[model samples]
Target: MQQKLIYILFIFASVISYGQVNLFMESDKAEYNGKDIVNLTIILELNGVDLEPQTRFQLPDLSKFTIIGSGSVTNTLIDPATNTLVTQKVSRIALEPKKKGKIKIGSVLVTVNNKIYKTEPFDVNIKDVVEKRSLATNISSEMYLNMEIEDREVYQDQPTVAVLRVYSKNMDNFRKVKDVRLPRQDNINVHPISFTKSEIDPSGAGNMASQIVAVFMVFPNEAGYVDVPSVSASVSSYSNKNKIVSNRVKLNVKKLPEGSPEYFKNAVGNFSVNVYNASKDKIEVEKPINVIIKVSGEGNLPDMYLPKIVSSPDYEVFSPKITSKVAPGTTGMKGEIFANYVVIPKKAGPISIQTEPFAFFDPASREYVDLGQKTLALNAFSHDQILESRTTVEKVNEYTNTLLETVNTPVLKTTTFKVKEKSKFHWNILLTNIAILIGLFIVYLLFKTWQKKRALVRETTSPKPLGSVAETEREIRETLKTDINDYFSYLENLKDNGDYEKFFDTLEEMDLEVRKQYLQSSSDDFRIRLESDKGSSVAEEYRNLSQRIQMEKYSPLKSAEGMEELLKAVVNLYSRISK
Candidate 1:
């Protein structure tokens, strides 16, 4: 009787389910660092002919997560594998873990009339936020550090980007990260660069809301497979400190192919070479004119430069005055570079501005790209005309100099001389004079001693102009309140402006002043307080920001960035420094 009743119940359940009913839970990422949003999608397929189009469902225990966003969509598609047109009602919920640990989303239940359907529980590993460097401690498995090179395979001297990022899943929010270390290899050159905090996943970690914390322009000096050591960093959060260590990365660098051009620059990147003049219509004779040679393109841009224009008797060419506006980007270092040559026509006639053909090894094409300006004649004065003007000037100068010499000639003369006789001195007068001399010297010495003592007193009593951390903080806050900080005010306009000297100089000064007043004195105090208040990232902000600032300020060729990234960082950090 029991078996018959169970069979009847199963038949009734299948009949009510219609074609084929199903419910499943899925996540976009297989592994998640605690900081990222764990996306959960609950999909329901209704395929039976007898079932209702829609039904109500209940979510499992999601009390441990903060739902930042949630939505549902309905769509019908033909399932090729199953060979059926199925209707799916998909519900997505973006969740941020409230706590760190190995956790799970419990089973979801759907009820219709008197029937109940359940979906299996989903397992989620939200890595623990350990507060120490020892990874052997009894804790859940964690993955936080990641490093990536834009191109794993490259030629010798070719440029690529390497990125290091630390994302802590154990913290409610990030406090700060610092001391990011990338192993140094003798065969590689690592140049640090600054970009805005971005969301592009250079490390292939995941497509979650994130920032590119550290970026480096990498160049390999040796040819062959090189093993790059793993990257590491110190990460701090509200309640925990994590030592993030990434997996090691490798780079394959190949030697340059044979048969390179004789004039080929030892650059391995794409580039375009152009040699042209400022004025197209006229080229004045025996005068200086600007001839432009612009070399601009992506690929090893930082190491690329224009070779000297070959010298010719027809014209004299000075070394190029290069102006670069290159900054790091998503791909690598990319921007326009200009080299201007001042050419003076020595012998005027039909002449051409001659320059050595610029060639660079184009890694993309696996060949050398060579280009020089087309042969264009300039209208100039002939050698005879140039010599005619010079001859006239010399003649005029010679005639004037001779006339002046003749007018100012010295007259011949002679004079006689006589010697003086010796005289005797008295002993009493000598003694009195000696006494006066001694008295005067003593007085002068006393005066000098007094002056030195007074100067020392003044220096010792003088007060420094440096402000305290509190004072500096208040001043920055006031500046922010008034919107008077010029660094942030006209940063956009200054980006395209040619001169960034003043900007970087002021930035260096600001960094120095802050260090002298705020960081050196009150760093630990404020760092502890801020971290206690869940704001350590602000403290760490200065660490990363100062580094980038120093790099930009001291780079061989600084970018006209106006340093918007730095300005935003400063503003963001200080704005939250209060309460």
Candidate 2:
């Protein structure tokens, strides 16, 4: 009987796991004009899988339409029934029609957990567009503007995409248009999305062509009806000035669900929050460490309410250094938001670095996700008990530096100093002054004797002019030897921060500077100039060294060995040039 009971429970768990994932893809409508832009949305739902999963969405059919703009949103929620987390990802793609007909949108392939899933194929009917002709004027034209929005109704703070397209079959390109017009409305914040044009069919005889020129991301602030005014563009024509306008759009925004807590951050999208120590767990007293609170994924990161770092007697907290790198996407913005606080330990003991719990409502799941207070456990050590591996750290443990690292640190006087009430003469002070004068006199006589000997030696050696090539080369080489250490140190600092991209760029610049001075040539073709000045042997060495630098700078994997080898080659080339 016990064995049978275990088997039943196992089967029940397998059924829930199998039904946890769902994928869906849909288009704007079943019908469109020949020159219209079709919008596609792909959504992936995970009932209990990892909140942050590696996901990929691929549209297999490229011949049906030309993609103009694309953006995506990823979010997570808590499921009340199973007491588990759910993740949802929504991707939006805008496509321009390649031809007018009944075109089928084939199955879209999405990969999750290395497993493939496909959406059912659908068809869209495209009808021929009729041009509006004016019976009064003889001037002919086939030009107009169109706007395509993802959704006509959305809840407050829920994001939607609005794309603008231009269609022309017989008219020439607009001549004097400087800017495209968009609506300015209250209670809605308009965020612009950037896109690049892809290869598409150009206008020709008996051909209908259109291009998506702009996209705007809209987020409603309140509930009720909202009107997005029509976008317009005016331009000069040869016979008659023309003005084209797109159709207006209206949005239905519903109020947020009731029972939202007062402390609930007005955040409306999917996001993940974390708090951690930038360095190791053991911190030294009087030395700074970084405790960071980071929120990244999707949604309104810029306006979201982040929890504060609670002050404690175990550590003295300083003002936080915040850095945000957010760019516009399908949603208003998507990127990482960081707030790092620098703290110094006051005493040595096991301590807790924590913040208040964070709460946000997920519009899709209609539930609240309480990412409970982020707590990082750390051990504070006395100054003398600090580990050897972390001794060299002087800056704040994280990305930003603290006030203690500033060059001009404030100094507090321990005791006040006042002028002596009465002045007194001392024998030792008078003796020291007399001795310093006599020592200076003796040193001057020895210098004069050495100068006479150096003059005698120069008489036998031929002296070069101040501006002579030989003199210039000597000065340049001396400067290079002195400044190389400073250049190397800066490069090392970049390497420590794991900024390999900037390191290569700065190293390339330093190589060019060294070549300009040593070769004494500013021309771009350094090898040719070098060949003429020096023999083929010297130039050959420089050419080989230049090739090495270029390869290392562009290589996929760069290491300390590569950087050191390249710098040594440059210095060795200088030695050959001098010889």
Number of the top-ranking candidate, with lDDT as the measure: 2
Model 1 bad stretches (over 4 Å):
1-144, 159-161, 167-169, 172-174, 179-186, 189-212, 215-217, 229-248, 279-287, 327-332, 372-376, 382-579
CA deviation > 4 Å runs, candidate 2: 1-144, 169-171, 174-186, 198-209, 229-248, 280-282, 325-333, 384-579
Clashes, model 2: 0
Candidate 1 local lDDT, 476-553, one digit each (tens): 655534232554454435545744667666555544444443334454664665465655566566556665666566
Give the lDDT of residue 387 in candidate 1. 51
Q: Report the alpha-carbon TM-score of model 1 versus the true structure.
A: 0.43
Task: Give the per-residue lDDT digits (tens) of candidate 2, residues 354-452.
Answer: 886777777669777777778888887775666444533342242124423552623312121111234675566456645655676678788889999
In order, candidate lDDTs are: 0.63, 0.67
Worst 10 residues of 2 by lDDT: 411-420
- How accurate locally is residue 211 in candidate 2, as Cα lDDT from 0 to 100? 66
